[model samples]
Target: MEATDCRRAFPSFDEPALKATFDITLVADKELTALSNMDVKEEKILESGKKATSFNTSPVMSTYLVAFIVGELSYVESNYFRVPVRVYATPGMEDRCKFSAELGARTLEFFEKKFDVPYPLPKMDMVGIHDFSAGAMENWGLVTYRVVDLLFDEENDNANTKQRVAEVVQHELAHQWFGNLVTMDWWDGLWLNEGFATWMSWYSCNSFYPDWKVWETYVGDNLQSCLALDSLRSSHPVEVPVKRADEVNQIFDAISYSKGSCIVKMVSIILGEDTFIRGISRYLKRHQYGNTETGDLWKALSEESGLDVAGIMDTWTSKVGFPVLTVSEDGNTIHVRQNRFLATGDVKPEEDTTIYPLSLALRNKSGKVENINLDKREISIDLSKYDASSAFYKLNADQAGLYRTLYPPERVVKLSQAGADNLLSVEDRVGLIADTASLSVSGYQKTSALLDLISLWKNEKEPNVWMEMLKRFGAIRKTWIFQPESTTDALKQLLGELVLPKVNELGWNFHAEESLLQQQLKGTLFSSAVSSENDKIVKEALSLFEKYASGDAKAVHPNIRAAVFGAAAKYGDEATWQRLVDVYTSPKSSVEGLAAITALGGAKNVDLQKKTIKLTLDGTVRSQDVFYVLNGLSTNVAGIQILWDWLREEWDAITKKFPANMGLLLNIIYICTGSLATPQHLKEFDEFFKSKDTKGFDKAVSISRDRLVSRIAWLERDVKDVEEWLAKHQSSTKL
Candidate 1:
């Protein structure tokens, strides 16, 4: 009854604007407990000798927040501020819920101060259901979570898992104020709730765990995710018009979550942290226990920050794409021109007069920061006082804005100089790399240029930079991994050279005094190492897998479990594959089970690939997690064609499988279309999806089609140049 289906539970107005009080009564077994939005008022015995519990009338809330659960669930309770917090799970898994409980209580207390609003509900329950989806739902007094996102075991789970658990907890609790207390009027303003929560969850998590670099995680993961979908032609605007339930479902995509969150981050930078928080507090207090639209937030922020915050933010949320700031030198000033940034290169006709309220951060030669707001298409900053002729100015200082910055090629080379990585901040470096990667894939820049820029990062020790590089390189690598044998071999060698040195520097073991982020980087580096098939890394991973199988106490730590298991599956024979499958099928934590499935999907044999494809649809994999197998199958070079065949063979059954959830199919489509290098791959993708019942899934199909088209264009534009560069690099290294 959460989303848009509260009418099914009881008779009531289901629209978000129709906020009302709920007096819920439940009749259940005497041994069971019932929980709702409000504290219990009374419990009485029915004529049949059954217990009936009625809760106090709830505060004004939307129908989505009106819920109750009656069960014999186990829980661990604690106190946060004046409010009590209880974390619940299935009976035997009660101990696994403690971490989320501690994290959730801390998060609620933090928000109470940050939002300038105290906890409204007397008690809050965070429940982890085994079959839950959507990561977690913020249901006022009671939050619901998937078991994997909420539960963590001390010895079995790693820092990465705990970080995920903490972030999810923080995200859902932030909603206690943003969504539960003052929700959007309707689905048209969904981003107001989701976007704020997404951005704040990372902000709150960073405040709590400064060492993890959660903001960088936002940039490297969430922000980049938005750029991927936004680059597609089928991408939707943030404030999407929702006239039907299906339209409502389509809007919960990267555009709403990622782009909206990034824009919010951009505005937050301009407003300054303290000012931004104050504005947020005002917005929440003014609209508490009521519904809001996007306008209400801007009005509050403008009143508090003394800026047209909403006016500055309107262009971003109303549009589907962002601008790329082109900077050039003009006499004693730096001239900047804004143009719509497209992944496939060039701008559209209607985007000419299109403007963005740019938050310009210009860094001078003295390392001073000057912030400017461009409410127009063009602006100039006089740099004569800073000796403009000597050194160039850096725009979008520290990457404070959501848009990309395109520097002249010579200027880019200057910035890519040795030791210059330390001159600029990590966020800008991440921005530069991400923008350049986007350009490379789109033909605006060559793969060689991207490679040259990344060579400067060869000595980079920052965890977030390495994380970005790992992901970008993997995306580019996936485009042509199925090339001719020689070309593919050369490509593999080049990739190994790019990442293995960093892996060697980081090493495989956890270091004393190292931060959790640094430790997490080890897992990513090892995954890169195995993917590249570095001799030293492959040997080490195999040894670790063998030692663990032979019952060695300290062989492969849980942190690198997936990497070792993947290596074993990639290089092992029938026996190793069977061992992984047996362990995967047995009862275990979600992470452990997913790790085994990951290895099974990475198997190098075609027969094993077929088996994996079958498992994706079969009941073996959870419906919510079938994308894991789909993605894994496409990741393996031997199964790309096999995956296509399976897609055609079972298109109807697959689409019909999830009548309730269609967005999950979009992710699978993206993964399957990832390796659409050849024309035949594109044709096959079109023949299957376009010829089927893809009415509600048109945007997804469009995105996947555009993805394949872009991959094909990338191959045409960059493959030859990349091959030449790889050959030259290989010869030079040998010399």
Candidate 2:
């Protein structure tokens, strides 16, 4: 059952007012285990012979936050705050559970001390579910995590992954109070819960892992997703509406999580941490076990700061896109104008009237930081008095502000070359690189900008800094390399000597190595034009997969196995491909059956591709099974056609018969059509689009327009045919 469905399981309301006991029950499969809030109060072998267990219901509290899971679990149990804490994982994953246990315990301790509240639940259980869709869910005292997100192997000292686990765990734990205890009135106030959680996650993780710049790391990852969505025509208010159950899931996005966090951080940076925490504490107390909206959060902050948050945050949050603050230096005057820049293209530029509390940061040559704000469209900062040689300015220096850069072309060029260490804070630098890389695709950015970023870490002193630089550089390299012959031996030598050596030096263990290898292969393989050297790399990858695939099934993690097969599918010989097909057809195939299908879907053979599509649409396919197949098909145009055909053939049947599939279809449509929403496909795609549910379908359509259609418009130089089609459909369709 969906978590929302559980509302009826107990006397629970969406608001925080509900205080009810959830009499929890779990029919744990003999192969798996279970966990809950309190210690297992009752455990028995059922008459029918199943491991039936029950945990004591939590203290009086809202129910939406409650969570439960049953899976193959191995746990290390301990006591913290006089409350039980068990970090659970799949069988043979006991070793990984240790990392999470340490992190979770520390996280619980941090929150207990910070909030000055007694731990409310009887026991805290962090269970790693292999197939969990989200990072980790804060289910009151019982948290359910994805295996990778929660579990960290002792052997795997990959600092990045370990840091991520600790950070994510703390983030969810904090939600115990922020989201679970004090719930949002409507989904609109989702930022209040998620944004705060995201911000707190970075803050807590940075405290716990001092070496890791958690806030910057988070913002770097976040900026990509936020900029992508914000540039989209479909972008909505951060505090978006959730009138139906499905709408709740749509808002669990970058804007709601990362950008929302950015917004919260902005408030904290501007209002000062003391005021931010004080305001949040007041909001929690005032809304404990009650419902509140966005205004309520603004009200709380306003009460503390004696400043109006409504006017400022509302302008940013209520609107769909972000502002590009163009700062130009003309003599002593620095002119600033806010505009919009799309991740894929420059679409809706900022109107002259668009406004926000423009928190500005100006760092001079001496590394002194100055704060300034621009309320109007244009503001002149007199820099005439400053040393001429000292004239260097970084807007939103700490990445405290929420907007893209519109600096001089030379400045954009310089920032790209400087990487994270020099021109910008580590977090903000990633944003610059991503934005610049997007521009490079359009010929607006120079390729040298990319090479500079890639070559950055060679000179960095800190290992973590070096590693981050390598990671981002590696990412850009992969994105830039698509055509055959794009790979050079010189480039390969750089990656091998510089990139691969650092990865190995980190001693990231087999799992982390495999993960990075996958990323590296993605960039290195297709990057070069089809050549003997490229074939050599492909053969090497195939050899690794074959060697690993034949290993002790128990030795390989399911994800690693999936990756091996995925890589093999990308670069394998005829015999290797056959072996993969054999695995797919074999009845003894494990949960990785869908993955095998993905491998075959991408096979050069058209017939096999069609069969892969059929495999997904077949009644034998589980709803869960569709994801891999859908993803595989999305890699190319032919696969996309097959998917579209299946949708066309079975739309009515699937919609009527597979009720559980509606949400999945919504997601699939968004990803599939959205990816190809360029001018060429817009006309063909119009036949399938029906705007019966504006709030629902329009979201997907708008996303497609932003990500796919807009990019196509720029590339093709005309969109009259697409515009005509969309216009006709808009009039005819119910939306």
Candidate 3:
């Protein structure tokens, strides 16, 4: 029910602008209820003793959002401003459906209020299916979700579950207004539909679950995810022009969902938040039940704010990559320059003149603030108005701007010092760490720069900062794990010193009153500890796993179970692995099942890890969930080699078994590339992916290839410094 798949479901013109009214009728078992976009028009028993139901013709809408479901589904019903709202699931899942059902109703009301448009449709139904894939489908009045994304059992579910379900509900509820009510004119403008939903959903979810800090989570999850992928040479322009239907799916990536929304947020920063919201409200009202391109939005926003949003944002949408700002202070003026951002360290000749009309946030020497807008290739902002001879500044204050920031050597030292003093806000910390991580891997900046920054922020306690910092450590670890034999011990020893102290500070115990993020970060911290050969952390993790396995403890904190299971598998014997298998066989929730599936990648021995990979291709792992194993196994250095070998051995069978689902296929190849430190590793990975039908994965393959490019580049640029640092830090304990 996504993109261009509507033609297969019904006979109709599938073009987005060729809207239609669907009059759907379904015949099913007499006991089952039928639902559709509109209220039921008629229901009767046919001569064949089957129930036939017809729905009222829906309002004019695109084909993809037109949907109906017939099943023995029970509902948890509620109302938002008198419109009936319900969440449907199998009879046994009624309790689990309650949270999303209520949230969906409230979210519908929230969007209505925010967009200044009433809900065009009569009712909304969010159905959680047992076998639903692609995360969640925003199917108009009939939003469909996987069980894990929609349902949360009050007793068994934790904060993560509640937060995820509420956010997905908010996400789909947003589509009801943006995609269903007002559609995109063409596939080229698909970002208008998705980007609007992504941006508003975060605001809507924060409207309800302020305590969950959904907006803050967006900075970590969506913004950072986009930054990581968009910096690559393989990344597509946000407003991509497509000629084939097959190409459309590839464009529905992080670029469309996350980066597009980030651009929208960056626009909001320029246009004040209230002014931006008002512009969206007016745009939705003006274009109600119609189509729009990127320009329409800019027109509405520009008219409201008088900021010439179109003039600025046109480059952002049309360009394929973002810029990395080199913020330097000279005399009394601050200079901001733009260049093509490339993780591979080589910009094509065509992109050399690329410049961005980016925004900058600077502080005066007295801590007074000034904002500058750069429209040319490079510009300088005069700080004489602030009455300061010397200016102190930080790029991308609050991390609202969606570009990387580089600092001079002296600036880096000052920023690192600021990080230690907690002078930087939480968002600034996330931004700095993410930029440093990307720069270090790409060889634009040395590994020592990133290490110095993280060293200063090792005591950082914010959830987003810590979570992002842990992921940065993964990148740093991958960069060094395959260095020359002379530097191997030094690399591991340095990582242990950097990470194990944090693990000790946050032990195995989960406090009842801790924030949900604080709880989850413990697992991230512990896994890093295990990866670096810290025995005390591993021993403690195994002890907790053993106690939880034999029913000795009341229950393990849901957040730490995967880390516990992974640690057990990596450091324990056969019995421990069997216990994890049992958890997979009989999971209390699909949430638990996923943790078990990922833990399977952490097998202690490489041979055992290969067997797990075999199990993944067999009936054990669902085809949709193979990404979890590939993604999880990337952390296990031994498992990374095994996954690559498995793909090479089973490429043909994999293609046949999972046809055209390049997301799953490319993930296996993508994870393998992260461990690429040698030319042999690069040759093996690039050759295999190139030999496959990677049409849906051109971007993914390019990303994996670039990871190798960056790693090789890093080895050339930074390994000498790494060797010196490692020699000083290396201990007797071999990792």
Best by TM-score: 1
Which model, 1 or 2, shows the larger TM-score?
1
lDDT of 2 by residue, 425-542 (tens): 5555655655555554433444455455555545443333443445454543433232123232334444554544343343212443343324333332222212223444445445
- Ranking of models by TM-score: 1, 3, 2
Pairs that collide in candidate 1 are none
lDDT (Cα, 0-100) at 678 in candidate 1: 79
lDDT of 3 by residue, 1-735 (tens): 677777888777888888877888899999998987788889999999999999888888888777788888898998754688988988877877777777877787877887778888778888888765477888778888888899887555556777778777787888887777778888998877788788887887767756667666776788888877887877888899988877777787788988888888888878888899999888888988788888988999999998888988888898878888876688767677777778876877787576777667655454445677776777776767654444355767777777788777777787777767776777777888888877777767777777677766777777788888777866766777776666765556566776777777877577677777776677677666766677777777777777888885345667666777788777666676666767766777767777877887777776667767876668777776777777667765687777777778887887676655434555556665667677888787767766666776676677878768777887788888767655554443343
Question: Best-fitting candidate, measured by lDDT?
Answer: 1
Backbone clashes in model 2: 9
Per-model TM-score, in order, reads 0.95, 0.77, 0.93
- In angstroms, the error of model 1 at 400 is 1.3
lDDT of 1 by residue, 1-735 (tens): 556768878888888899998888999998887888788999999999889999988888899877788888889887754687898887888778888888888888889988889989888898887665477888988888888899988767777898989888888898899988989988988887888888898888889889888877777788888887887767778898889766676677788888888878887887887888899999999999988889999998899889988777787888878777887865667778888777766567775466877768777666677767787888877877554442656677666677777767777786766225476778777777888888788776788877787766777888888888777877767887777777777767767877888788878787557788888888888888898888888999999999977877358777898899899988778788777776667635778777877787788876777777787777877877777677677775777777777767887787777543446776766677767687787777777776677656667778878878888888888888988887887898899
Higher-ranked by lDDT: 1 or 2: 1
lDDT of 3 at 131: 65
Query: Whose lDDT is higher: candidate 2's or candidate 3's?
Result: 3
User: lDDT of all predictions, in order shown?
Assistant: 0.79, 0.61, 0.76
